[model samples]
Target: MSLVSALAIYFIIWWMVLFAILPIGVVTQEEAGEVTPGTESSAPGRPQLLKKALLTTLVAGVLFAGIYWLRVHSGLTLDDLPFKPPSAR
Candidate 1:
């Protein structure tokens, strides 16, 4: 892949991994028994966003590496998928 394409793929993968990781290890104010008067109980008591972000970056990097290998070394392409319509094939 070109530099732009590689960067774009990595960016997409990073965002996806971030979303997937966001709900993990969550602690709501209600769950922690520390719901403040003004805030909703459903709000997170300690989001630990920095840690999740770091983890997301690591996971996304590994996933992107696998995808890059499939695209480059394995010569896998969109047309090779089995679900394509007969006309397209």
Candidate 2:
């Protein structure tokens, strides 16, 4: 893949991993018993976004490395899939 394609794939994977990690270890204001006035009790008390972002980057990097290896070194392609297009059949 070209540099632009690699970067784009990494960006998409990073966002997906970030969303998947976002809800982990969440602590709502209601659960912590410190709901601020006029704020929703369901709001996260300590989002720890920086930590999650770092973790997401690490996970995404590992996953992207695997994908890159498969694409560049595994010698596999869409044609290797077991299923075939109806038209092709």
Candidate 3:
């Protein structure tokens, strides 16, 4: 893939991994028994966003590296997908 395409793919993967990582080790206000005034009980007591962001970056980098290796070295292409458009068929 081109540089822009590679970057776009990595961006998408990063967001996906971030969402997956966001809920890990979460402690809701209700769970912690420390709901702050005016905040929902369901809200996290401590979001730990910086930690999760770092974890997400690490996980996404590994996933992207695997994907990049497959794209460059595994000889895979669009043709490897199981489906085809009607026109192509």
Candidate 1 Cα lDDT to native: 0.96
Model 2 alpha-carbon miss at residue 79, Å: 0.9
Give stretches of model 2 more than 4 Å off.
Answer: 84-89
Q: Per-residue alpha-carbon lDDT of model 2 for 1-89, expressed as tens digits?
A: 99999999999999999999999999999999999999999999999999999999999999999999998999889888798557843
lDDT of 3: 0.93
* Clashes (N, CA, C under 3 Å) per candidate: 0, 0, 0
Best by lDDT: 2
List of clashing residue pairs for candidate 2 = none
Q: What are the runs in model 3 whose C-alpha is more than 4 Å off? A: 84-89
Best by TM-score: 2
For candidate 1, the TM-score is 0.90
TM-score of each: 0.90, 0.93, 0.87
In candidate 3, which residue pairs clash? none
Q: Score candidate 2 by lDDT.
A: 0.97
Candidate 2 similarity to native, TM-score: 0.93
Q: lDDT of all predictions, in order shown?
A: 0.96, 0.97, 0.93
- Find the number of clashing residue pairs for candidate 1: 0
